[model samples]
Target: MRVHLGSDHAGLDLKNHLVSWLTEHGYEPVDHGPFVFDALDDYPVFCLRAARGVATDRAAGLDSLGVVVGGSGNGEQMAANKVEGIRCALVWSEATAKLAREHNDAQVVSVGGRMHTLAEMTHFVELFLAEPFSGDERHLRRIGMLGDYERTHELPALPESAVGLGPDA
Candidate 1:
C-alpha cells in the first residue's frame, strides 16, 4: 500500500514518524510536507496534496491511502474532505479507525497530534490500514448515496420511515 502523509507544524513530528513506520512495515510513504516547521503553516496546503495523491493513485488503479494531521485534526479532516472522491475520516480510537475503513471505505484518515500519545495514534493508523471495507449491502448503499450527492449536488429523498417523522410532522 502507498500511504500519503501531510501535516502542519503541530503534526510534523507525528507525520514524520509515520513515514518511517510505514516504510518499515513494507508500505510506501509519500510525504507531502512542510519539510521544515513553520508555526504559521496551513494544513490545507499539505493535506489537500496528500488527499489528492490518494485520489489520483486510486483512480489510476493503484492501492493508496492518505493521512493528514494537525493540532486538533479537525481542519485537516475538513480540508481533505474537500477533495473530490476522497473519504477522509477523523479517527480517535481503535473502533473509529477500523470503522473508517470497514464502514465508510475511507481512503484518508486524520489524526490529532495533540490528542494522543505517539503509540496510540500510531496504533490507530495501523488498524486503519489493516482493515478492509465490509462491502455489505447497507454499507454500499449508504456510500452510494454519499457519492451520488457529491456528484449531483442534490439531496437524496427522505426514506419512507423518515419522511413524516420530523418535529413539525
Candidate 2:
C-alpha cells in the first residue's frame, strides 16, 4: 500500500516517524511535507496534497491511503475533506481508527500530535492501515447518500421514520 503523509511544524516529528515506520512495515510512504519545520507552516498546504495523492492513486486503481497531522488534527481533517472524492476522518483512538476505515471507507486519517503520546498515535495509524472497509449494505447505502449529495448538492430524502421528527415535533 502507498501511504501519503503530511503535517505542520507541530506534527513534524510524528509525521517523520510514521514515514520510517510505514516503510519498515513494507508500505510505500509518500511525504508531502515541510521537510524542515517552520513554526508558521500551514497544515492545509501539505494535507491537501497528501489527500490528493490518495485520491489520484485510488482513481488510477492503486492501493493508497493518507495521514495528515497537526497540533489538534482538526484543521488538517477539514482541509483534507475539501478535496473532491476524499473521505478524511479525524481519528483519536483504536476504535476510531478502525471505524474510519471499516465504516466510513476513509482514505485519509488525521492525527493530533499534541493529543497523545507518540506510541499511542502510532498504534492508531497501524490499526487504521490494517483494517478494511466492511462493505455491508447499510454502510454502502449511507456512503452512497453522501456521495450523491457531494455530486448533486441535493439532500438525501429523509427516511420514513425521520420524516416528521424535527425540532418543531
Candidate 3:
C-alpha cells in the first residue's frame, strides 16, 4: 500500500522516522513535504496535498492512505478533511486508530507530534494501516450520507422524532 505523508516543522522528525519505518515494513511512503523545514511553515499547504494524493488514488481504485502531523494535529486533521472524498480522523490512541479505520473508513490519520512517544505514535499508525473498514450496513450508510452531502451542499433530512421538538416542545 502507498501511504502519503505531510507535516510541518513540528512533525518533521517524526515524519522522517515514519518514512523509514514505513519503507522497512514493506509499505511505500510518499513524502509530500517541506523537504527542508522553515519554522513558519503552514500545515495546510503540505497536508492538503497529501490528502489530495490519497483521495485521488483511492478514487482510481488504488490502495492508498495518508498521514498528516503537526504540534497538536488539529489543524492538520482539519486541513485533510477539507478534501472531497477524504475521511481524515485525528487519532490519539490504539482504539482511536482502529476505530478511525474500522468504523469511519478513514483514509487518512492525523497525529499530534508532541502528544506521544515515537514508538507509541508509530504503533497507532500501524494499527490504522492494518485494520480494514467494517463495511457494516450502518457504517456504509453514514459514509454514503457524508459523500452525498459533500457533493451536494444539502443537509440530511432531520429524523421524524426530532421534527416536533422545537422551542414550543
Candidate 4:
C-alpha cells in the first residue's frame, strides 16, 4: 500500500517517524511536507496535498492512503476532508482507527501529535493500516449514499420520523 503523509511544524517529528515506520512495514510512504520546520506553516497546505494524493491515486485504481498530523489533528482532518472523495477520520484510539477503516472505509487518518505518546500514536496508525473495510451490504449502501451526496449537493430525503413528523403525518 502507498501512504502519503503531511503535517505542520507541530507534527513534523511524528510525521518523520511514521515515514520511516511505514517504509519498514513495506508500505511506500510519500512525504508531502514542510521539509524544514517552520512554526508558521499551515496544516492545510500539506494535509490537503496528501489527501489529494491519496484520492487521485485511488481514483487511478492504486491502493493508497493518507495521514495528516497536527497539534490536535482537528484542523488537519478538517482540511483533508475538504477534498472531494476523501474520507479523513480523526483517530485517537485503536478502536477508532479500526472503525474508521472497517466501517467508514476511510482513506485518510489524522492523528494528534500532542495528544498521545509516540508509542500510542504509532499503534493507532498501525491498527488503521492493518484494518480492512468490512464490505457488508449495509456498509456499502451507506458509503454509496455518502458518495452520491458528495458528488451532488442534494441531500438524502429524511424519513418523516427523522424530520420530527408523526409516522402517519
Candidate 5:
C-alpha cells in the first residue's frame, strides 16, 4: 500500500519514524513536509498536501489509504477532511482505529503525537490499515449521505418534494 504522511514540529520525530516503518513494512510512504522541524512550522501545509495526495492516489487508482500526524491531530484531521473524497478519522486507540475503517470507511487516520507511545501509535495505525470498511447497507448509506453533504449542503431531494410541487396549492 502507499501511504501519505505529514506533521509539524511536535510530530516530526514520530512522522519520520513512521516513514521508515511504513517502508520497512512494504508500504510506499510519501512524506509531505517539515523535513527539518522549525518551532514555528504549521501543520496545515503538510497535512493538506498529504491528504490531497492520498485522495488523488485513490482517484488515480494508485493507492488506497493514508496516515496523518500532529501535536493534537485535531487540526490535521480537520484539514484532511477538507479534501474531496477523503473520509478522515481521528484515531487514538486500536479499537477506534479499526472501527474508523470498518464502520466509517475512513481512508485516512489522524494520530496525536503527544497522546500515546510509539508502539501504541503503531498498533493503532496498523489496525486502521489492516481493517476493511464493512459494506453493510446502513454503513454504506451513511457514507453516501456524508459524501452528499460534502458536495451539496442541501438535503437529498426526495419524493416528498413532489408533494409540494403544485405552486400555491
Candidate 6:
C-alpha cells in the first residue's frame, strides 16, 4: 500500500525509522517533508501537507493515504484533520490502530514518538495497515454527518434526546 509519512522534529526519528522499515516491508512510504531534522520545524507544515496529499489523491483523481506524527500526536492529528477529506487518527495502541482503520476508516495514523518504544510504534503501524474499514451503515452514516458538519458548520439533525441534549431551553 502507498503510505504518506510526515513528522516534526519530535517525531522525526520515529518517522525515519518507519520509512526504512516500511521500505523493507514491501510498502511504499512517501515522505512529505523535513527531509533533514530541524528544531524549528512546525508540525502543521508537514502534517497538513501529508494529509492534503492523501485526501487530494482520491479527490484530484488518484488514490493514497498517509500517517503523521509528533511529540504527543494530538496537535499533529488535529492539524491533519483540519484538511478536507482526511481522517487522521491518533493511535497509541494496536487495538486503537485497528479500530481507527476498521471502524473510523481512518486514512492516517498519527503516532507520538515519545509516547512509546520503537517496537510498540511498529506494532501500531502494523495494526493500522492490517485492518480494513468495516463499512457498516451506521459507521458510514456517522462519518457522513461529520463530513456534512465540516462543510456547513451546522449541528447534525440527529434527535437531541438520543445524543443526551434536549432543545437548548
Off by over 4 Å in 5: 156-169
Q: Rank the candidates by lDDT, best first.
A: 1, 2, 3, 4, 5, 6
Q: Return the clash pairs for model 1, or none.
A: none
Segments in model 2 whose C-alpha atoms lie over 4 Å from true places: 167-169
**If ranked by TM-score, best first, what sequence of candidates would result?**
1, 2, 3, 4, 6, 5
Q: Residues 21-86, candidate 2, lDDT per residue (tens digit)?
A: 999999999999979989999889999999999999999999999999999999999999999999
Whole-model lDDT, model 5: 0.89
Task: Compare candidates 4 and 6 on TM-score and give the better one.
Answer: 4
TM-score attained by model 1: 0.97
Candidate 3 local distance difference test against the native: 0.95
Residue pairs that clash (backbone atoms under 3 angstroms), model 2: none
TM-scores of all candidate predictions against the true structure: 0.97, 0.97, 0.96, 0.94, 0.90, 0.92
- Tell me the lDDT of model 3 at 79: 99
Off by over 4 Å in 4: 163-169
Better of 1 and 3 by TM-score: 1
Cα displacement (angstroms), candidate 5, residue 60, comes to 1.0
RMSD of 2: 1.3
Worst 10 residues of 3 by lDDT: 160-169
lDDT of 5 by residue, 1-169 (tens): 9999988888898899999998999989999977997999989899889999998998899856888898888988999999999989999988899999999999899999989998999889989989988899989988998899888986655456576675523
Q: In candidate 6, which residue pairs get closer than 3 Å at backbone N, Cα or C atoms, i.e. clash?
A: none
| lDDT (Cα, 0-100) at 49 in candidate 3 | 97
CA lDDT of each candidate? 0.96, 0.95, 0.95, 0.94, 0.89, 0.88
The TM-score that candidate 3 achieves is 0.96
lDDT of 1 at 127: 98
* lDDT string, candidate 3, 10-124, tens digits: 9888899999999999999999997887899999999999999999999899999999999889999999999999999999999999999999999999999999999999999
User: Candidate 1 lDDT, tens digit per residue, 72-105?
Assistant: 8999999999999999999999999999999999
